[model samples]
Target: MIKVLIADDQELIRQSLQIVLNSRQDMTVTDVAADGQEVIRCVRKNVPDVILMDVRMPKMDGVQCTKIIKESYPQIKIIILTTFDDDEYVYNALKYGASGYMLKGVSMDELVGAITTVYNGWAMINPDIAAKVLRFFSQMAQADDTISVREKDMEELTRTEWKIIAQVEKGASNKEIAKNLNLSEGTVRNYLSTILNKLDLRDRTQLAIWAVQTNVRKRVET
Candidate 1:
């Protein structure tokens, strides 16, 4: 079964999530936290497979909590659950290694599906949020001249790494890349870390942006 941790400040929200998730045959709520600090504590104790995290929390906040979780427990996937859809929050959450971004108002069915989706090595986002993410990327691409790609770093990637980079450039998350390449998700994540380190990029978001700026994906076509 997929072990999950629900972290939110509101009692109602936590109870609602626990109810929705516990009803699933393939998943269970192992723990719940009222705030970000409690989230870290629960994680250290339960070591859940996935964490449903709220962005705004008293004491530690979800963004910082996510960063710490990703750094310390790299295997644990996190889905950002929030009522706010601000660009900065979304971008920073992605930057910090969130596997999914979903608004809190999503239906219980959708939430269950999203948790399953992330567990199976895929990224999930609310459809409406995805549209916003696309628009954000489009605008970033239009302002391209401002973002620079280092030529020396670009030259350092191997052919396989380049192939992986092309997938990431297409906004394919680690899971999507694994599916497309017929590789394991762990392998995709390893490749992603190598790519990030080699390219001196921060995360998949930066890697995607750099891919567009450098036209790395074009190399695949030609």
Candidate 2:
């Protein structure tokens, strides 16, 4: 069973998601929270496998909550449930390690499928907002060319690491990356960490943005 947590400031959304998600055979709502702080509390106690988080909860907001949850529970996957207008929040949420985001208008089946997908360690982007999300990532790529990062860092990555980075650019998680590169998830994680350290990037989101800007796969081909 995929243990799930629902966090939305609106009571109706929290209840609606809980009722619908619990009816699914493969999922159970372990906790429901009405704010970001409560979301943290529930997660600390229950340690759910997947979290459906609202983007604008009071007290902490989904972006900060996602960051804290990921920092404390790297194994837990979060799906930001939003109304699909907060571009900055969406970018930061994904940057902080959310597996993906879904508009609240998504059909229950889609939401359920997303839970299963993230539980399987894959990112789940809603097609409705994919273009907007990609634009946000592209902005991240172009918005700060003057940032302190050194371009020479790419030269330090091994070909295997380049392959892993290519997967990240496609929003593939460690499990998907491992399958793509014929390596274990542990090996992918290790390589990813090394790559991040070498590039001085913050997380997979940044690495993915860099990959898009640089097309690191070409390095592997060369």
Index of the highest-TM-score prediction: 2
Top candidate on lDDT is: 2
Considering only N, C-alpha and C atoms within 3 Å, which residue pairs clash in candidate 2? none
Q: lDDT for each of the candidates?
A: 0.80, 0.82
Candidate 2 stretches with Cα past 4 Å from truth are 143-208, 215-222
Which lDDT tens digits does candidate 1 get at residues 1-222? 999999999999899889978987889999999888999999989999999998899999899999999999988889998765566776677767887888888888888888887776656767666546645655667773335657897788888788888886666656678888888989988887787788776555566656766677789768
* Model 1 regions lying over 4 Å from their true place: 135-222
Q: What is the C-alpha RMSD of each candidate to the true structure, in Å?
A: 5.6, 5.4
Compared with the true structure, the alpha-carbon lDDT of candidate 2 equals 0.82
Per residue, candidate 2 scores C-alpha lDDT tens digits across 24-123 of: 8888999999888999999989999999988998889999999999999999999998875787898899877898789988898888888987787666
Number of backbone collisions per candidate? 0, 0
Task: Tell me the lDDT of candidate 1.
Answer: 0.80
